[model samples]
Target: MTEEIIIAGFGGQGVLSMGKILAYSGVMQNKEVSWMPSYGPEMRGGTANVTVILSDERISSPILNSFDTAIILNQQSLDKFEKAVKPGGLLIYDPNGITKLPSRKDINIYSIAAADEAGKLGLSKIFNMIVLGGFLKLKPLVQPEFIHKGLEKSLPARHHKLIPDNEKAIEIGKGLIQAVQVLN
Candidate 1:
């Protein structure tokens, strides 16, 4: 199976890190993977996005014009990548920053209230992992064990103590995602 994914959000929101973790998880599962990140000039608060490709076979290239899944964290990303999702694909977004809801019938749409849920859990850093969990719940592209391993691999040793909290955030996200009505 091949999954091309785009994850987008404002910088400091862990957009790139989410993609990295996903890619790392794919690698841990013995899948071919690629990760590419883009961001605006201002590092902290600027727009940021990443493209990740995972496949059972060899990947041709990292560049892509469309994706099988789009994980949008903010309004800007929702606007930018909404149409980039392939027909019958998946579009997952966090409702916190979206001003305009997605209107597409050809693809599956889901909303994960990551920000609100993270706030409720008192976790400011594991927000992305929560969203990742929601996505996994919908897609199940990679195993949960791989995700845990990916967290261990992606995080620095000093931050390893927070793995349990991150795991909890992922579970929270899995429960929070809800399917939205598809527009015709």
Candidate 2:
């Protein structure tokens, strides 16, 4: 089956990068994928969004009227896209950012405190990677190893050293989900 995921946040939160990494993982797994980014005039400080589609078969279109999954990194994003997810779709949000919980019972919503985890790692920028980790853990759409390798390849050669740290961020994100699952 194909999955369409949207990642959104204010600029500089790595919203686009999060979608790219997930799409790259799909490529590594031999899936057809597309990464489409939405940018506003202000670019960095403005609202940013990305749509990532991964399919076992050829992907027809890059535009997603609705999504099978969504990761919201800010309150505005959550309010804007939370209703766009398909019925019974999955939605993941950063608890640090979202002030209101989703009211739809048909959609599965997860509130993860990824910013706190990234802060503990001394890197607030890695919050996006943490959200990606939760996506992998809960959805099983792509392998973590594949995602890590894709991230390494997608980064600039000059910044290759950051791959290991990114992988660590992903791990911590997965750990958070696992901990919550255990609690439940």
Candidate 3:
């Protein structure tokens, strides 16, 4: 099974971290993985994105024009990668700052109000974990234990104490995601 995903959003939104966690979890699951991140020099509020590829067999390259899934966290990303998802693939996004919704019937679309929820719940730091949780609920790509280990592996030791909170965010995210009507 090969899953090519692009997670895109503004910088400081943990887009890269989410991709890294997925990459690490795929490694723990003994899957071939590749992670590539891109962002403007003026990070923070600038746009940021990461591409993560997981597969059972050897991956040919990290570059990709299309993806099996696209995790969009902002309006800009939605505008950019909405067409990048392969037909019958998945497109998950947070509808906070999005002025326009996705209008594709060929792919399955899901929305998770992660950013708003995180702000309300005071889980802003783990917002990406919540998003990750939503994706896992829909895809179940990697094992749970591997995700825990991935959290431990990706997050620095000093931040390890917050794992439980992150886990909780994930659980919340799982329940928050909802299917949107596929449009033309």
Candidate 4:
């Protein structure tokens, strides 16, 4: 199976890191993976996005015009990538930053209140992992064990102390996601 995904948000929101962790997870599962990130000059407050592809077979290219899944953390990303999702694909977003809800009939849309839940759980840094958890709940393309291993591979040793918290954040995210819209 091949899943082409786009994770987009403002910089400092862990958009790139989320994609990296997902790519590493795919690798840990013996899947072919690719990750590509894009960010503006403003960096910390600027727009950031990443494209990740995980496949059981060899991947031909990292560039894509459309995706099987779009993980949007902010309204800007939703505006930019909303139409880029393939028909019958998945579109997951955090409603915290979205001013306009997505209106699409062909795709399954889900809302993961990552920011709100993270704040409630006092897990601000691992917000992306929570959203990743929500995505995994619906997709399950990669195993949770692989994600844990991927976290180990993606995080620096000094930050490894927070792995348990991040794991908890993921679980929280899994339970927080709600189906906003479903295609019939």
User: Model 1 over residues 91-181: C-alpha lDDT tens digits?
Assistant: 9999996789999899999999899888887897889999999998998988989988998999999999998998888888889999999
Candidate-wise lDDT, in order: 0.91, 0.82, 0.94, 0.91
Q: For model 4, state the Cα shift of residue 45 in Å.
A: 2.3
- For all predicted structures, in order, the TM-scores are 0.96, 0.91, 0.96, 0.95
- Residue 37, model 1, lDDT: 85
Better of 3 and 4 by lDDT: 3
Model 3, C-alpha of 97: deviation from truth (Å) = 0.4
Tell me the spans in candidate 4 whose CA falls farther than 4 Å from its real position: 40-44, 182-184
Better of 2 and 3 by TM-score: 3
Per-model C-alpha RMSD: 1.3, 3.0, 1.2, 1.8
Point to the candidate with the largest TM-score.
Answer: 3
Those runs of model 2 whose alpha carbons end farther than 4 Å from true positions after fitting are: 178-184
lDDT of 2 by residue, 1-184 (tens): 9999898888998888888888888899889999989865856688899999999998988987899998888888888998999998888888785566666777887777888888886878788888888888888888877987788768888988888888888877887753212122
> What are the clashing pairs of model 2?
none
Candidate 1 lDDT score at position 17: 89
Ordered from best to worst TM-score, the candidate numbers read 3, 1, 4, 2
lDDT of 3 by residue, 1-184 (tens): 9999999999989999999999999999999999988855945678899999999999987989999999999898999999999999999999999999999999999999999999999999999999999999999999889999999999999999998998899899999999999654
Worst ten in a row by lDDT for model 4: 38-47
